[model samples]
Target: MVKPANKPQRLSLSSLKADFSSAVSRRRLVYLLCTFFVIYALCYQWQFLVSLGLGPDNIHHMTVGLIPAVGAVVLSLALYWRHLCIASVVPTALIAVSWIVTGPYLSYITLIQQNTVYLNNMYDIYVGLYLFAILFCLNMAARQFLNRKISAAIMTAVQFAAFFIIALQWVYFALYHSCITTSGALLIFQTGPAETLEYFHSLGVGRIVFIALFVALLIGGLLFANYTQKTLPRTPVYRKILPLLSLLIIFPSVGALGEEIFPQAFPIRTFIDTHDYMERSALYAENHDGKFAALQAVQLNPSESPNTVVVVIGESETRTLMHAFNPNHVENTPWLTSMKEDSDFTLFSNAYSCVWYTVPVLERALTEANFYNNKEFNSSISILDMAKKAGYKTYWFSNQGSIGVADTPITLVAKTADVSEWVDQELKQSTMDGALLQFLQRVDPNEKNFVVLHLMGSHIEYRNRYPKEFQVFNDGTVNQQADFDNTVLYTDWVLSQIFEYAKENLNLDAMIYFSDHGSDPDKGRQPDDISFKVLRIPMFCYLSEGYQARNPEVVEAVKQNKDKFFTNDLAYEFVCGILNMQSPNYDPTYSIASLQWKMERKDLVTRFGKVSLLEDTEF
Candidate 1:
């Protein structure tokens, strides 16, 4: 093809306006906006409903959720109302503003604002999208395969079903705080096979009648709307362009099929994925329940003097980063270094986190669970269960979030405790760790209590982990290192507060502080890096004056184990030894303070999938 070589045309505002007006009439714009808005709502329905049940931020959630439905109804009316020379702006304004405000860019913004991580990031709010895709796809498919009469029938059925579901969901949410899930289904079934209907009836026959009546009204309203939408007389030119819109909608779901890849840009797929997760989660919950119930009871012997044990679990911290433990003189750990020389505090020289992740490591550390006998450990009962049975109050205070309670395995452990309080609502980095202290100060401290404080220490996105006022080494180092040191410094301050309270105010026994896992400080080290620093964690015991005066043997154990090679897999047994609380599961060899305790080749588990073969690591 030969170029005509015409001079390039300069764009102008008037020409642009004319092109836009010719391409998209007000009626077509309304239809397009309404179409896409419906799709967006479908993707976010689950997230929106969840936020509604959350403590705060429901107003924003409500706005995002309702706009699409209002747009849909208005657009449906506009279809027939236009024939009667009624105002189209009623629908157009609502649909147009909603579409642009909650468009793709807005979806990304909403996702970030929601502070969703992992699976949730894949599912949370995106500007109105999922519903539109389904509608547009249905219309285009109908246009190709069926006549206008059949197409109308198909659309009405879909719209009615969708409307009915939405109505039903509202009532269901009112009755129960949550949506249908596998755990809920199992719990319902566990009540009794025949009690499902009786349970519904128990809500009162009046409530049932009201729900039925409401559903009937919604169905009638949907039918009326569908009739008007179908009977609209004029054929619009935008109908030709709708096929093109349908292709664009379909493109996200199947566009990568040509390259043999399936991406997650489609909204409807998130809903499907959520449904699948619900089913799987429900099955697992049911199976786990049976095993848990069948397990032998947790047994513990209460000592002559009831002990008040406190466990502080830190995050993403390594001994190599702490000034108290590391060769380098890092001022980030000033408190720990100052406290190290105190006879009441015992700093363990050789300690390693058992696993790389928070939940996995804590599961075994707090309970008896391990990779080897997971079924038995998960079912056997936790230290919290035993603590309660032994007549001690157990409390779980966390700086982390309580979202995804079912999927978060640590939540199951938390439930075994007498009291569980999560200070952080969102999973964002800005939530301070000091909030855990508020819960601690308010709780009854005089009683025989076992409290666990989970902190967000030195986790990723290091810059967001600390405030500017607390920053120390920012001007002349890699920013990641400065941010990391800032977190550790903040952690040092936070830990000192807990210690002061325990020693000065509470009837404290001993407090043990350790990390869940260690991370490479420079940032972004590969998971496969077999470095000693990544697994090595700083652990110390702060024994109150009363505790030391009562149990002299625990002090001796701490002294003897100061140099022992400690892996956190033995943490539960060690806790048992520290508190002198004996259980049948407790092994003398697993306790570092015990003479029989010894490190073997099989004891060391590394991130690179190695065991029992560390070359140069020593405590």
Candidate 2:
């Protein structure tokens, strides 16, 4: 490619006008602007509709979700519109804009690139591509019809086929994913591919009905288009405005709004479907007293304390696969195995999470809440309050969804710790640990500290939770085993790094790590399904050298006490044994530290049918 010598070019307003007119004709501009504007408004309103069904920041989530869809639809339409008229460059440029907006970008670079791979993959599920194909054909058909180049019947067939395919995806998603009392099937659909197929296979009558209805809609849309054409108004504006407005208003409202509002009235559906998802959370509050009293031991006891206590709340960690719990499995817990041996640690062979999700488990464990249904407990006194009462500084950190819920406990935890950090999904995973480390550094060395770190851990779509470098499966073969192994390894590495920080930086007395609940390893159940794996978690304590020396008895007690423990026992056991605090809710029967009742057996089962090896006998 040789560079030509600079050629003088004439510059004039007339030349610019001619170029602009050629690039974008007035008729095309009207159609494009009308289509895009209508689409934008409908999508924006649909976003709001979807948010209405959800709690708290439903608006924020729906907004993030709509970004890709809206961009893709607008761009796809523009591309088709230009391609229909045989205008090349302008359509291509519009497509490029859509791709860049929806795709990944390097923050530091000016080289604007789009992720075609992502778009290509999305074509199958997204309805926008189908819509583009339909409209392009329709536009072509309309042009031909006006020019007398094609028969009405042939054009009608194309319109009908396009309408059917495009409409089906939305209908399917709505019928299946809508959060309504009647559409629990949507839960099955949204879960993933296997579940959706399975549900389809099982639906004998429903499948037939859906097929029939789909055909009806297809025939209806085609007839409507054909009838409108025969009665073609003299004004093009009527043709332009009617179909666009109808689609813009109907598709999103019926799809998004209907799906969200469907389940709003159902209390059971809304209540149990939460981060705190134990079936009978309210019962614990009903039957139990002194919900916040158990923290007395952890807060009041001077012998167990030197400086800091970190309560790292994990999500969905199970003991069956944890190498520490299952010594037979070498890879199950390679990191924890090394950590336990390297650091002077005490491992409880039997420890179970009381509830499965973060909110209920954390709220119940930290606060004076007995159960998950007890919304009043969200504002109640908690372990943070106990630490505040004990004059110890407290801090809470998390990497979870629900920014509103994240702040609830953190506010209380901050009142006690003098400093707290609540990290949500907004921050990058790599940046989170650094932010926490800085918070730890900023705290005064003179004050006793209570720091809590909540992690996403091995949650579903496990691949996304961890960085790629930690992914051990090289063949691109993904399954439950690979996902589990990768998650365990990444989490183990994270734990080790945090432990290293504890070792080198803070003069910590003890670092206790436990999960909120366990997840099903079978991959046969829902993510929220209660199983042994869901309750079983890696619960252990790492005692710093400085604190161990000062609290010899506490260390001895930890060394000796190796029985099964339920998280419900934490407030009682840790408080009585470590913090040396006293409370009436500190029942000897439920307390892990109560030697007198250590022989008693109890059935540690949650309302969601999750049971674990807990207690000496059924309680």
Candidate 3:
């Protein structure tokens, strides 16, 4: 026995090989998981990390922390690269790419620039990551059962669809400098074929070609990567673990937390919100007739004489960009600027739209339901109803869309007028606001008239909003700000035309002008990224000598409150007060033209009272 022991136990080659293989397997497992963790963190938390690292307050952290953290991540990724399974890694990478390429990351950056505290918090990051993890697990499970060819086909199709969506979002961001939202989707649903064509055409050939090429290359590369991927030998443990992980991730999203978490995901969440909006719009339409019928008539107190009043509702006109409001800006509103010298003309220094969208803003601006009143929108009576009750013939002339697939709440309010006319009968053309002047020509001078002129002022595709002659800011170059300035100029011209016609022909006693909502020239009026400029609308009242004489106290009140904070949702009450009409809905406190009118800066709000104007530093 001793002689046999003395020979020394020789290590078996197969045993040594088995030990080395086990260690390699363990390292590969650790690396594969690290890869998943890295992708997950980048997909959901990059925006937060970026904001944290690059924020003005984080300069010290950037020097000491961020750079080292980035280096560590790079090293980890390199180590993980060799162990990555193509079946898992490729789809995850594609999903991560979608998150980056789509509008969210860009929008996040833009928001952070404007406001340092705009980054998503840890809670939001976790929710997004959880949802993404569930999606990844499902993708893994799909690959586990399907053959390599079928898996590749499915993966390619998914990536292609994702690429197509990303391209659409990219194109939208390029044109609007913002993300496509539920409101944007509503605009799409409301748009007619001709308008849709114009929208795409506005993207120009260069952008169109770039988007097409970019998408084609992305899809082609993704397809190649997916198809050329080599199938790795999957263990029974892996097969079991993948299904279990998928079930675990899916359980939370399908259970109580699903409703809250799932809607936080992009593209899918956008689609969900759009669908919800459609359903709400349909319900509103269905209930609108009854609501209209149920509206109570307000008591009419006539003026000393039959007055011809015109309310000019401008679209996407921010006072911050108007020369009359911001003297530092370009002189695009020379007519309004000169009108300021007139004794009868009064320009409100602080005026905001209750909401930043056309439909919601107009719904409240034209109705008795204001942000402060808490009145139901459907139940409230419109300005048309109030005017008609006072025995004035009401007319609505709009250069904007009148009818889409469904009647918007604003359109419903517009239709309540004695006559409703849209420049584009089918919303099929890009008609200038000048076309609305033709409708004003039909006004009967003898009758008491209340006319609404809704102009497409400074809306998107700003170049199309004006004629070639009105392109004063153009230097034979593509400048969005210049195009916007040209639109403001054109709008000023349009306003002057409307005012002169009403004054010279229709015995215009009083004329009021206020935009439905304002817009950001750089970033169109996005609800989520609302700035004070987006709510800071241009508001002015032009009182003829006759109106000034008859309503001197009201005129005095208007002059006094011109510098006070006013939101357009109170336009109804202001109109009532100015016209010397007595109504149950009339609240002198809300009316800027009433001696009792009062509003504090703290009380001011926008986005239908959801956001405080105090949040905006510009306000």
Residues 1-619, model 1: lDDT tens digits: 9988899899899999988887767767777677557645554454433321121223344455445444443343333333432122222232233332322333333334543221222212322233433443554455445666665567657655534433433454467533332233335335775687888878898998987888677555434443343322224533554445555555642333223211232223333344544454455456555654544443333444555778898888888888889857468898999997788888998788766666567767777665434434445456666566556789988766443422255666675577886653323333568767777775575577888888877776455455668877774543366667788999999999988886666667779898888877554445555466677888998877766666676668778878777777667767766665555655656776555566654565644234643654443
lDDT of each: 0.59, 0.49, 0.69
For candidate 2, what is the lDDT? Answer: 0.49
* TM-score to native of every candidate shown: 0.61, 0.53, 0.56
Once fitted onto the true fold, the runs of candidate 1 whose alpha carbons sit more than 4 angstroms away are 1-138, 149-307, 371-375, 403-407, 424-430, 473-479, 521-533, 607-610, 613-619
The lDDT leader among the candidates is 3
Best by TM-score: 1
Q: State how far residue 505 of model 1 sits from its true place (Å).
A: 0.5
Q: What stretches of model 3 exceed 4 Å from their correct place?
A: 1-306, 403-407, 426-430, 475-479, 610-619
| C-alpha positional error of residue 563 in candidate 1 after TM-score superposition, expressed in Å | 2.7
Give Cα distance to truth, residue 294, candidate 3, Å. Answer: 7.5
Candidate 3 minimal-lDDT segment of 10 residues: 114-123
Better of 1 and 3 by TM-score: 1
